[model samples]
Target: MSKPIRKAVFPVAGLGTRFLPATKAVPKEMLTVVDRPVIQYIVDEASAAGIEHFIFVTGRNKAVIEDHFDIAYELEATLKSRNKTAELELLSRYQPPAGQTSFTRQQLPLGLGHAVWCARDIVGNEPFAVLLPDMIMKAETGCLAQMMQVYAETGGNVIAVEECDPALAHQYGIVGVGESKGADAFAITSMVEKPPKGTAPSNRFISGRYILQPEIFDHLSRHEKGAGGEIQLTDAMIRLMADQPFWGTRFNGETYDCGSKIGFLAANVAFGLDRPELNADFRKEIARLLG
Candidate 1:
């Protein structure tokens, strides 16, 4: 059997300039979607997918992100004193097992490639995952868990993909398909990051989740800047596709791009609507807005 995917890398080093003043004080990953922090949702998904080692590629002023995963000693103590077992158990899920979490400094704003490269030492030569914290996915099953199922069965580089409208293809890396594997997965032949509208090969756009082989480090190391004069992970993945197999799992999830203010607010509203206590109030507010 293929070795189980045990490690995951979270690229949370972005400045999150798009979120502006709100991000000035808080790391975007710490921003809440309803009640849970954005990064926590991704962590829960990874944990659910059986990922044991969690690595964070972070930068300056990102201490809050690290602290969020750490055990809050005083808070836990208070909860224990009060015997609020239910509340305490819920909070404990956020605290990763000791020694299972590791953090590395990206130290630069080079790009996603550099941020991912920063974690190579910790990742070693194992196939590791990269999950962008800005994208929060809500689905019947977690997106990462869904992709992990595909990776174990297929044993190749796998990415979470979603078929998007052709006009919106330029907003993401578009993947070209070779053949249909099954219901929700496809073999990728080529991919381009934000190619000009009509020039895009296909509408299967790359999302934030990637199950990348360690060999990608070689391609990323030698890769020149693409798209935005920054070394893009897609560029390296494109090169990796030439040699090995790359599968795209048409993601089954409602993804929220919390990198933008509008998307972030929308995620909060969407999540609120799912809450039993807030659903009625949220629906009323939404109706008022429409009216």
Candidate 2:
């Protein structure tokens, strides 16, 4: 039997240069999609999938993320004094229990692989999940939960994948499928990061969610730089696949890449329309703007 995945790593050490002034001090993971920070959505998903520990691989200027997850005593006191019970309850809903979260510094702008490697000590010898905070996934069952189901049966490396236009294959790590594992899962023969146009094995791109065995640390420790001269996680994963089973599951969700400015604005609109309190008015405003 596969060891249950109890820990998850959130790699949020990037400088978020795309957002510039807004991210000058604030970590990109702290940016709100609608009302909740992007990282909270990911953490909530992990928690729903039975993740017991949240490990954050951070960098300089990321103290705010630590503080975001930490309890705000003054703010809680003010809310309590005002009898803002509903607001307090809402805040408490997102706060993970004390000692369930851990933070460690990546200490460099290496790459996604290195950032994940930063959490190796905490992950130890068990299977762990990796969630990229910039991808805001919307689904009825939650992407990570769907992945957990696949993990339960497959018991190996499981990656969340979604179909993208063939023309945009260069923008993502495309999976080369070997055989069908089930209706929504496949045996991944290989993965190529940002393959050149027309050279992609398939249009099914690897999204932000991953359930990896702890042995991957060995490959990442080499710090091998592939595409863009960075320690791409795809490279480490490719090496890991040489001796282990790697499977991909098509996620049951719509993902918005909030790492980009346009995608961030679109996520706001998408999430805004989903909120009951703001839907009608936000829909009207959007219709007016488009007209």
What number of clashing residue pairs does each candidate have, in the order they appear? 0, 0
The RMSD (Cα, Å) of candidate 1 is 1.5
Residue-by-residue lDDT tens digits, candidate 2, 69-152: 999999999999999999999989989999999999999898999999999999999999999999988888889899999998
- Which parts of model 1 are misplaced by more than 4 Å? 288-291
Backbone clashes in model 1: 0
lDDT of 1 by residue, 84-132 (tens): 9998998886788899999999877888998888888999988988998
- Lowest summed lDDT across 10 adjacent residues in model 1 is found at 221-230
Question: Which numbered prediction scores highest in lDDT against the true structure?
Answer: 2
Instruction: List the candidate 2 regions with Cα displacement exceeding 4 Å.
Output: none
